[model samples]
Target: MINVGLNHFLIVSGILFSLGLYAVVTRKNAVMVLMGIELILNAANINFIAFSKFGNLGLTGQVTALFVIVLAAAEAAIALAIVLNIYKTFNNVNVDEIDHLKD
Candidate 1:
């Protein structure tokens, strides 16, 4: 059996990115889009940690990944608030029909 290594992490990240892309492309709901963004961020974090642990990239990669996770949480909170506001304002969360405020 092939020993798991950085390649495994890369493969997982690639799969995650693909899934996120599909979600973003096929989803019509704003919340689903947010979920896809979260998945993408998580995949990046996975790669960061993997490189930090297995490669010569040193500790900075892990530190950066930690910051990314924190920022992702903050971003998720703010984005959710905005989505909630949009839902309250429009009574729907569809992404393609909210272009009326551009006057």
Candidate 2:
């Protein structure tokens, strides 16, 4: 039987982080960048919970993860709103093209 441990969680989290980074770096669409940011936040949450469980950190990790979830939701809402505005003004949601604040 393979015992899943902290190392396993860490490895998975690392992979998620890398994927998030790749998406953020390579994607041109604002929505895709937001998704990548979400992925990064999720990866961090995974690490927090995993460390909390393995390091005997009580409820701190779980509580922090909850807070992070709430923050991520709020962030997504605000970002999407801004992206919508950008799309309305520019007719596109590409991150690179929306370079200036002025029309």
Candidate 3:
């Protein structure tokens, strides 16, 4: 039997955050960047849940994680809409390629 502790959760969260950051920094597609942002948010939620469980906090972590989820959903919706519009206008969804909104 293995005991999963806060350190274990922290390590997982750190990896997720790092991967998210790398995706955001290295990907040229807007959608990939959004996915990376979601990954970062998920990593934060993991930390929140882990701390809430290990630190004896009552419902705070869960509540915060829920709020983060909601926020991430809304952000994704709006960002995708913007990306679609940009694609419609510029015929490209690449973040680096669509730098100018006006031609």
Candidate 1, poorest ten consecutive residues by summed lDDT:
94-103
Q: State TM-scores per candidate.
A: 0.90, 0.96, 0.95
lDDT of 3 by residue, 1-103 (tens): 1687899999999999999999999999999999999999999999999999999998999999999999999999999999898888988888888767676
TM-score ranking from best candidate downward: 2, 3, 1
Candidate 2 local lDDT, 19-85, one digit each (tens): 9999999999999999999999999999999999999999899999999999999999999999999
The candidate that wins on lDDT is 2
Worst 10 residues of 3 by lDDT: 94-103
Candidate 3 Cα misplacement greater than 4 A, ranges:
none
Winner on TM-score (2 vs 3): 2
Best by TM-score: 2
